[model samples]
Target: MAKVKGEIVINSERCKGCELCVPVCQQQTIAMSDKLNSKGYHYAMSINDECNGCINCALVCPDGVISVYRVKLKDAAVA
Candidate 1:
């Protein structure tokens, strides 16, 4: 079976920007965004094309703001 690629989403509102998820991810997929949230703190955001579906970001996020969405596969045969 082939592994499918996915993307991880982080919610800016709930994030405290504690820099907690930065060291947890082995792939270094998550990075602090320049934009600040409503709380005026720089929140962590995933770099483009960096996530590898390891779910490390989701697991480490204290605010439960991370979400993983798998890419849909195209059907090889016409229905």
Candidate 2:
């Protein structure tokens, strides 16, 4: 089987800095930004490219401002 990678996109402006997504990320890909959004809240940001396509962050986001994508790594494909 091919290796799967996860990509996460966060709507910073809409995020409430609730920190709900931070703990759910097993890969530690999500983090709170020091910069504040228009709402004066520290929005969530992708700290690394280690996401494994897990939707835990999105599912835990109360604002529904998180998006998750999955990519199959061709190099790890099965014969």
Candidate 3:
């Protein structure tokens, strides 16, 4: 079976620095940015490539700024 991978997109401008999604992510994929957004608030961001599309962050976000995309990669052939 192919392995699953995921990526997340966050709308920093809409984020309100709530940080609600930070601890809920099992993969530790989400983090708060040091910089502020256009709204002058810290926003959630995806820190790494280990996301599994669990949608925990998205579900927890009150502003609904997080979006997750998942894909499956086929295994490489043996040499």
Error of 3 at 3 (Å): 2.2
Give the C-alpha miss distance for residue 48 in model 3, angstroms. 0.7
Candidate 1 least-lDDT 10 residues: 70-79
Query: Considering every candidate listed, which one attains the maximal TM-score?
Result: 2
How high is each candidate's TM-score? 0.75, 0.90, 0.88
| Candidate of highest lDDT | 2
Against the true structure, candidate 2 has what lDDT? Answer: 0.91
Candidate 2 stretches greater than 4 Å from native = 76-79
Better of 1 and 3 by TM-score: 3
lDDT of each: 0.78, 0.91, 0.87
The digit string of per-residue lDDT tens for model 3 on 1-79 reads: 3277888999899999999999999889888999999889988888997898888889988989888898876566211
- Backbone steric clashes in candidate 3, count: 0
Q: What is the C-alpha lDDT profile of model 2 across 1-79, one tens digit per residue?
A: 3288889989999999999999999999999999999999999999997899879999989999999999887873523
Candidates sorted by TM-score, best first:
2, 3, 1
Scanning candidate 2 in windows of ten residues, the lowest lDDT window is: 70-79
Q: Candidate 2: how many backbone clashes?
A: 1
RMSD of 1: 4.1
